[model samples]
Target: MSGRQEQINLDTLEPQQLAQVKKQLDEELEHLTNSFAQLHAAQNKFKDCLRCVKSRSGAPEDIGTGFLVEKKLKSAEKFYESKVEELGNNLKDLEVIVQRKQTNARTIEEVLRQKILASQGQDQQQA
Candidate 1:
């Protein structure tokens, strides 16, 4: 990428235009940062998940001890998987929230335009 930046026309933008742009940039940055964090976190989680297989690969424990360790390791794997699934669900919820906000914003924009036109009509009628 070229190390160049173009001047923005923020000065000429209506208040609504500026606000919408800011909202979009904020959402995009949030998603980008979250995804990057999740990527690194998942790498670490995979490393931790190896414990599921490692418990069986090492020197054999006593038969009685082996059952306990296997049980514990299986529990740990379940816990880890559940945590990852919870995070995935949380991300989905966030997506739903952002979608709701977009819908609400559009609704507000329409209402504002209607109000503005109504006020303009009243002004003309009075004139």
Candidate 2:
């Protein structure tokens, strides 16, 4: 629950432990949000680079150094393409983790809160 890259950590808790689980869920969701933002920025940058490469390719290269620049751009284009795929995969994984965590925390919190309320009602009735 350090809010790092990894997902939720519910270890070392009692069977019905809830607070720590909630904490881990919150941290995981936040981490996923941050990662998604980073991936989006990378995707936009890759698109910009792609546009530049395409535009340059259409230019009539009637001078030296054009080939070199084109070659460099090709290499960069490949790199960006691979990066886009990688980021997309990462985004998908984080999305799954976040969704799972959200469901689990909500379920557990609802159960625990209801249990607490029921116990309070019993105590008042007995008093």
Candidate 3:
């Protein structure tokens, strides 16, 4: 997986299977967390490079490959900027997914709690 969200039919899963799915979601969330950190570091590196490029004087070779290198560097800066935007969007999406998963897990927990409470009530009444 590209650390992207998968479509799960939560209604079709048994409680045990839902727990398994939650575990898998947790693992995926951990992976995405690391990926986010790495992406942020890479974004910082790209920003630094862009700053360095912008601060430099004219190319050393007044009319040759130095100029070409400078041009390519500018092009690379644009590319990196686009990549950063894309990563930011991905991060946002991942956050939304994490939130949804948490909500679902909480809902499941509440349901389980209610079931336990009901079972206890029944036992007390029988006793």
Best by TM-score: 2
Model 1 C-alpha lDDT per residue in residues 1-127, reported as the tens digit of each score: 1236455455455556756766775676577557756755784576577565555645434566446555666677777777767766666665565565466556545555665676689999999
Candidate 3, residues 1-127, lDDT tens digits: the string is 3456567665556656666766776776677677767877877787777677677666544456446666766777788778777777776777776677667767666555565676689999999
lDDT (10s digit) by residue, model 2, range 1-127: 2246554343434435666667766887787788778888888787777777766754344357546655666788888788778877877887777787788878767766776787789999999
For lDDT, the strongest prediction is 2
Candidate 3: give the clashing pairs.
Answer: none
Candidate 2 is scored at a TM of 0.71
User: Which lDDT values do the candidates have, in the order given?
Assistant: 0.61, 0.71, 0.69
Off by over 4 Å in 3: 1-25, 59-67
What does the lDDT read for residue 84 in candidate 3?
71
